[model samples]
Target: MSDAQSLWHLADGRALTLAGAAEARRLAVSRGRVWLTLSGTTDRPAEDCWLEAGEAVALAPGQTAVLEGWPAAEFELLVPPCSAAPGRGGLLGRRLFGG
Candidate 1:
């Protein structure tokens, strides 16, 4: 398998929102430095830690991570449930239905 399938890129000053138990995994970088802020929960970001370009960090579930600064910076992000994994379909298939 090619690693290209596992790569994701985010533009500067852009934020991504995740719902439910979803998790975001990827490699990211920011020009000078980037800040990640977690809102809607009791979790807070580490003090004075900026995400530099060419760094990898795994965003914890149930939190929103915001990327700031750096234009043209790129990163790789891998969402949960493994897109190429067998037997696992879309979110609808994983939901419960009443009889």
Candidate 2:
């Protein structure tokens, strides 16, 4: 099995802007609740998804998604886990995710 990874954290009303790849991004909440807004593209419309404690959500790649906390929340991104090689979208992997 691959090792686990951490994505980002949020406090009440806080939000994080993230980029996803062609593969869906797997987001798992560790505490509290979170809401997601998937941005629309020329091909697709926007969408919203909600997740509570112990719940998770998957987001399609190729665009940015917004993650906001209900009150307080901790989450981990499953897909496209941190990699040594920089992927599409950004190159500041270590700066954004961690080493």
Candidate 3:
């Protein structure tokens, strides 16, 4: 994330629902451990993966997934850069537009 503080924060037994797992490029567990479960799609059944703190994983496009903080966790997600980010518009936007 551009701003590290914006990282996803979760409590014990809490979960973060991700809608565009397909568009997601990477997931990083910054604190504690988490269970990442990919939802079933047309061609495949659901799959689950685990990540401890400091671990990062690549994600396949076009999938849905649920991230859970089994016992408390914090994580960050990196998606493909957008044409225009909400604030600085990302590196590309800033370079092209000249903020």
Candidate 4:
């Protein structure tokens, strides 16, 4: 996993921008639903998939997705080469649950 990172929490009716040529590897949603808008492409609705109470999506290298209409949604951003490993639980499990 690379050390690069970006994180954001968006609210309803709000939109976050992803600069052109920017590359994001993973996005973990911690809260509400969000819409994704790719650069040079039309904005589209993206369902908020729940992994845990505070975990959502994880992308691979060169994968990019914008967020919109994510009211009160917490998201942890991970950049290329720094992908989340499989089989390992989430922060809550490792922290409170003691995975």
RMSD of each: 7.4, 7.5, 4.2, 9.6
- Clashes per model (N, Cα, C within 3 A): 2, 0, 2, 7
Against the unseen true structure, what C-alpha lDDT does each candidate score? 0.48, 0.73, 0.73, 0.53
Ranking by TM-score: 3, 2, 1, 4
2 or 3, which is superior by TM-score? 3
Candidate 3 local distance difference test against the native: 0.73
**Per-residue lDDT of candidate 4, residues 9-76 (tens digit):** 78778877654434435566666766665433343333333243355554433444567744556677
- The stretch of ten residues in a row with the least summed lDDT in candidate 4 is 41-50
lDDT of 2 at 95: 57
| Model 3 lDDT-worst window of ten | 79-88
lDDT of 3 by residue, 1-99 (tens): 443224888899888887754344677899999999987767678889999999987666667668989799998876655422456565665676564
For model 4, what is the error of residue 50's alpha carbon versus the real structure, in angstroms, after optimal superposition? 11
Q: Name the candidate that leads on TM-score.
A: 3
Summed over model 1, clashes come to: 2
